[model samples]
Target: MCGIVGYVGKRDALPIVVEALRRMEYRGYDSAGVAIVDDSGHLMVDKRAGRLENLDAALAAHPAGSFAGTTGMGHTRWATHGRPTDRNAHPHVSADGKAAVVHNGIIENFAPLRAEVEAAGIEFSSDTDTETAVHLLALEYDGGEHAGDFIGSAYAVLRRLEGAFTLVFTHADHPGTIVAARRSTPLVVGVGDGEMFVGSDVAAFIEHTRDAVELGQDQVVVITADDYTITDFDGVSQQGKPFHIDWDLAAAEKGGHDFFMLKEIAEQPQALADTLLGHFENGRVVLDEQRLSDGDLREIDKVFVVACGTAYHAGMLAKYAIEHWTRVPVEVELASEFRYRDPVLDRSTLVVAISQSGETADTLEAVRHAKEQKALVLAICNTNGAQIPREADAVLYTHAGPEIGVASTKCFLAQIAATYLVGLALAQARGTKYPDEVAREYADLERMPDAVAEVLKTGPAVRDLAQSLADVNTVLFVGRHVGYPVALEGALKLKELAYIHAEGFAAGELKHGPIALLEDDLTVIVIMPSPSGRAVLHSKMVSNIREIQARGARTIVIAESGDDAVRPLADHLIEIPQCSTLLQPLVSTVPLQIFAAALAQSRGYDVDKPRNLAKSVTVE
Candidate 1:
């Protein structure tokens, strides 16, 4: 994954480009660089191999803002083509130094292209496939077809590259212009009165303008200080569709938190509320994916949920809710492993695919595989107009706006909310629940926002406890039912941020294998089962807590406020509001998020951008 920003504006381009890179750094942080065509016709590029701060320091050391110009491009690379080193960073230049290019996405045919270019006596300075594109662009620019036409030369180069990419190129001679091309990967263009901006997402230019255009596939855009033009790969002009970004700059900022992850965790109450809005109609829950008629729904016999990482956990939770409410057997599988297993599927089956970005490679591939089996596919995604939604039979937008943190927070909550809607819709279709019963469930969901807000009030206490537990080398979590996924997610958060050994297990399986890991002073966090409707699970979880405590382990129990039984046994008790057992995760998950961020911060690590992770996984 990588983030790109290209701008042609009257304002100071250096600061604008740098800030855009910072905003989209969640996309990639392996390395960063910027290329600007200076007023004197010198194309300059300055780069660093580490975090964006290193590049900022490098720019600050220079007096001229490290490459000031009116037209420029920027990149944050995740290191697909080469090792993340100074020489292999983005904004690579050609041998003659006339052309510079910043590229996102992998080039499948870079090997042969590199060999042919080298055979022609063109020397490459870096190991990245991106450099090969710039070299080929220089060769194409010097050709007789369009020797001095920057956009034409760029279009010619795009015609040859055979992979997903969003490329930004600039020639020294074209000091007042920049050319950008989009293929399979996303590229957004922002429109201003006397300026233009192009980026991988709207966050790149949200600080300057909210009006933007979503560039189509296989299109080329040429931008100048006062105008912009668009064309197809074969040179036919096309109209670019524009839309306004609903969220403003405040949504993207940290709002005084040390990391964006912390602020996003605190914003979950509102995010889930937004996703829950406008779903009630005719005294029942409704969804945007109304393509399925009730007759079609009754014809369905099974359900399959496919996802990856955190989305996979959400899918697991969905399986429990869907089966209990719709009386249909549901199975959840990892998207990466779904198609490989040759799962039994048919038109009678419904496949629910969940993703925040809607561009996850494995999920998208899984959708195609489901269609190959003629199964009805439904997508639960946050992004509008993403590839997955367009390919699916129907779509349910999560409406979680923009989540800038590398680790998912608000999107996960919104996804679970969307899954609840899907469950209610199916229940209504199958006559499993009466309309009034569905309305009551919808009312319970309507109350979840306030529940999440009440949980947020415990952030300071959870954070301090997590900071105290930072010295522990390993953390373990256990749960009985829906709490099991919350346990797994809690462990995942600790492992992701604290970089420590962590694991989650079903409370019943403690004696099977995982219980052997418990020892003196080892921390075991328990997501206590709610005592409302599941008294058996509550009693069983209390027994599990006693067993772990007997092993000389420190127990941190996240229990409901009135659970006096677990309080006596819990070494450190964390109270969450009482809610339906199935929906307790929406609140139990908040403490885990805050604890992970605090523990990682106490260890002096960057909680927002973890090592070897990107916000979106564009490649399989």
Candidate 2:
């Protein structure tokens, strides 16, 4: 994944685009660059390896150029095709300096295209697939019927390309215009008075304009200072669906926090509340967008959930709830491995896809495959107008606002809340639960925001415990029933932020194999179920705690508010608010997040931007 921004506006393009890139830096930060069409019809370009600050320093040192040009584009890369280097940075320009291009996503046929261009006796500059696009554009503009036609040349180049990409082009001859197109990647056009903008997401130009036009697949857009036009690749006129961003610019900024991760963690309460708001009307649960009718939901025989990373963990939780409520068989599959398995499907099957960005490469492809097999597809997503939701038969928006943290916190919780609503809706549609039972479930959900807030009160204690164990070589987490996914999520957070060796196992499976890894003073965190409900699970967990403690392992137990049975057994106890058996994840997951952040910060790591990771996975 990479961040891209383009501007054809009255304001200075360089600063505007650079600031937008800063907002989207969580997307990618391997390298940064910009290309601009100056006022005198000249192309000015600069790039630097490493973070955006490196490019900023280069711009500061060479401040005499035409960075003030009103037509420009910028890119912060994630480095898929080549190493992170100055020459490999984006905004790859033509040799004659007449055309420039920036791109996101992969070009699968780039090798053949590069060979063909090189066969024409044109030398190449860098080891990036994006450079081939610029060279082809320059060649198309140099001669032939498309000669001197900038948009026409861009169209010609786009028609020859295969694979997913979002390309924005600028030509020195076309001073005030920008041509942009998308095949499968994300590209949005922001409509502003006397100006226009294009970026990977609304966060790029949200400060200047909230009105945005979301382009469909295989569409092209031409933007000038005062107007914009949309068309298909074959030159047929088309219109992009427009929507206003509900959150403002301030939501994208970290307000007096050490990092965006910390801010997002603190915002979890509001995130969950907002996701649950307006979901219940007229004593029934509803979805954000429901193209599938009630009869369609009732006819479902099997359910499949496809997702990756934290979203996959949310899907695992959804499996438990959906099956329990609707009595339907649910299967959770990793999106990367879904289609390859050649799963059984039909019109009666319902496929649920979960993704925070909704552009996750594997999950989007899985959704496409499910739709091709004539299965009804429903999507759970955070970002509005994202590709997966746009292609699905129905969608449920998480309403978590902008999650800028690379390691998700608020969005993960919001996904759980939204999935719970989906479960209730399915149960209602299938007549599996009475209307009064569904209302009670919704009421219990409404009280979870406060329960989550209560869990935040224990952050100080969790941080203290985490700091003491920051030097440990390995940590193990164990849970049972619904807590199994929470344990897995905890281990994932630790591995993502702290870069430590961590593993999660079912509490009952300690003796199976994971128990051998336990040694003297090794830390083991156990998520204890509620003693009031499922006494069997709580007792079994206590036995697992004892098994680990007998091996001289240190214990940090997360239990309900008053669990006296574990008082004498736990070396360190962290309490969370009591909730229903299935709803425990909503509260149990908070302390683990706090503990992971504090532990990573204690080790002097940047929790916001972990090494070798980007916020979104746009490439497979």
Candidate 3:
């Protein structure tokens, strides 16, 4: 996961590139750099192998007016081909320093290509695969006279390389032009007046303009100061499709909050309500204008939900609900591993692909594979009109607007809510539940926004508990039933935010193997099931808490209000509004989010942009 930004415009490229890198800090990086074509046609490059602040410090040490250019490219790199060092950082330059390139995605055949370049007497400077690309371009240049000749040579060089990548290059000879190309990786062009921008994603230029262009497969774009041209590998000119981004620059900002996570945590009430709105109309759940008949749903034999990381956890929770409501066998698979194992599928099988950003590469590929196998693919996506949604047979959009933080909070809740709605719709269509029964479940779904609001009110206490545990080296989460996935999400948040060694295990599995890790210094966060319909689950989890507390483990209990049985064992008790067992994940995940955010903040870490992590996984 790397971030790339390029600008060819009238404004000074330094400040714009630097600010865009800051916005992309959440995408995780070990180094930052920028290369600019100055007004006098000199290629000026500055790079450092640390956080953005380290780059800023280096820029401050140089003279104020040292570098100037109207066009440039910048990159924040997550090391793949080399270590995190200045020489290995992005914006790799040619031996003659005439061409500068910033690249994302891995190059599978860089070794053989490097051998060929060395055989031709070309010298290399860095260990990055990107350096091979620049040197290859330099060899192809051959001191070309026409711009088209140089462009054609660059395209020829790219044709020899293998593996996924998005490349943006600037030549000193063409002072104001930037050449960009992508294959299997994301690249977007931002349109502006008398200016053009290229980046790995749309967030890079949201402050400048909302207008953007999506680059399709094997397309190349040459952007100049006043215009841009798109072409294919065979030198045929092509056209670009324009897309309008709805979120403004303000949504990417923290709005004076301590961190992006905290601001996002506070935005949950509105986010949940926004996701729930318009789903219930005329006593039925409607999904993105696609209506399914009872026969269509009843004919389904099996269901599979595929996702990665937090989205996978959401699918785990969905499996419980969908199986209960529809009386169908459901399996949840990690999207990255789904296609490799040759999964069993048929016409009657339904595949649900869950992703907050529908651009996740592996999940998108899995969706495509499922469709090829003749399975009906339904996408539970928060992003509208993304690749996954376009490929799926149907889509249920989660209206949790723009989650900028790397660690997911509101989107997880929204995914659960959306998956629950899908389950209810399936049950209603199959006549498994009466209209009144579906109406009753819809009432529960409607109350979720307020229930989520009530759970958020417990953040203060959770924050206090987090501060007390900030010094603890290890934390463990244990739960049963639906609380099991909640525990996994809790541990994931802790690891993502606090950078601590944490593990989540089912409470029943603790004694089987994980109990040995629990000791005096270890803090255990247990999600206690509500003492309502799932009395067995509630009693079992309370007993598990007691078992761990007897072992000298500090217990942090997240339980429903008025649950007196669990109070005695709780070292820190965080209350949640009572809801059905299937919907408990919506409320149970709140305290975990607050705990992780506050703990990370207390340790002087950036909770929103956590170390070595990006907001989306666009590369496989």
Candidate 4:
């Protein structure tokens, strides 16, 4: 899950490449590096083994003053093929220093390839599979050929290797060109005036231009100082479809916040508002696209929500609403393991695949498998025109805009909001809930942005609590029903941000195993269900809180403003705005996000760029 950014443009390549790497910091990199072609046909490489700030300090120390040829490439690496050392950092160079390559995704067959290269008398310096690619390109360039021919050779070499990858490289000999290719991973090309850019995604070049071209599977792109050409792996020329990006570069910036996570936490109001826009009118929910007819939706007898990580938590939240509103059973499955188990899905089953980026390999594969089984596939995604959305039978797009942080923030809220709308649509179509009842739910959803805003005002308290517990080694979260998923999300955020041991469990399951972990020193965050809506769940959770509190755990209760039942057991209480039980996740999740971000910041870790994590999981 590394980040790759490249440019073939007229400006000084050093600053642009470095800035792009900084923008990509949220994608989780253990090391950062850049390689720029100089005016004298030399590839200038600079890299460090720490965060991007370390690389930035190095750049400042040795100011590669206006290092000027137009072609360059950069990488922020998450160590997988090698350790997090300077020698293992990306922008791997050829032995002769003629070519420098940056890559994302794993090369599964690199061991055999490396053995063959070593047998051929090539010496390797780093342990990364990416280095093999650079060596192969060097061998290809050893032949006297044009840049395009060498790119074709490189493509052929890549074709022989197994696994997923998106690679970009530039040779010193080809001073004004950068060659790139992708397979089972994402790579986008940004077009600008008199310049060209390539990145693992659009966020890399969103600052320069909003126009981008999505590279197709097994396509190689040859970019020059003034032109770019796309071709298939076999060298036949192909046309690349270009799309316009709607988000401006400002969205990627921190906007004076301490970190991207905190900034995103504050942006939730606008994000929720944007997601809610155009979704409801006259007591009916509307989707971005209606490919599935009412007959198609009504004929569906079962539902499967497939996702991974935070998206899986969203799916869990969706399951509750879908079942409650439509009177249909819904199952949530991790996409990576969904197809392997041979689930008994059929024509009557509807597979709802959720992903922020539609490029999640396992999720996309699961969606494909479901379609093969003749299941109607629906994709809920934030990104437009991504692979899963394009391939699915129907799509519900979450208009939360760009979420850059590796650990999700606004996307979680957007996903829950989208899923709620989808549930309402299903209930409306199936005649399960009354029209006025649906309208009331819609009205509750309309108030969510403000509720989110109110929850965000708890930032100061959360920050204080985070600072107090920054040194704690472990945290436990417990919730019932919808809060259970919120607990899962809470634990995930803490693990991602704080690098601490955390676990989330259903409160009902606490006495079974997890309550034993509760001690006088341990921190327990309980999401108290809304007492106004469901008395049973609310009372059960309160009793659960008292159980843990009696066991000497320091209880931090997140309860609705008017819920006084949990107050007696709460050592610390965080109050959220009053909301419907089903919609509480949209409010409860906000405080946990703030708490995690503040804790990471207090620990001196980068809240936006946590260790060993990336914003997008492009590889399986």
Clash total of candidate 4? 0
Candidate 4 whole-model C-alpha lDDT, 0 to 1: 0.87
Q: Compute each candidate's TM-score over C-alphas.
A: 0.95, 0.99, 0.93, 0.93
Give lDDT for model 3: 0.86
Query: What is the Cα-based lDDT of residue 160 in candidate 1?
Result: 86
Please list the Cα RMSD from the true structure of every candidate, rounded to 1 decimal place.
Answer: 2.0, 1.1, 2.5, 2.5
The best-first sequence of candidates by lDDT reads 2, 1, 4, 3
Q: Give candidate 3's total backbone clashes.
A: 1
Model 2 pairs whose backbones collide:
none
Task: Estimate the TM-score for candidate 1.
Answer: 0.95
Ranking by TM-score: 2, 1, 3, 4
* Candidate 2 TM-score, true structure as reference: 0.99
Q: Please give the CA lDDT of all the candidate structures.
A: 0.88, 0.92, 0.86, 0.87
Q: Between the candidate structures 1 and 2, which one is better when assessed by TM-score?
A: 2
Runs with alpha carbons beyond 4 Å of true place in candidate 2: 63-65
Best by lDDT: 2
Task: Itemize residue pairs with steric clashes in candidate 4.
Answer: none
Q: For each candidate, how many residue pairs have backbone atoms clashing (under 3 Å)?
A: 0, 0, 1, 0
The sequence of per-residue lDDT tens digits that candidate 2 reaches over residues 492-566 is: 999999999988888999999899988899999899999988999999999999999999999999999889999
**Local lDDT at 145 for model 3:** 36
Q: What would you estimate as the lDDT of candidate 1?
A: 0.88
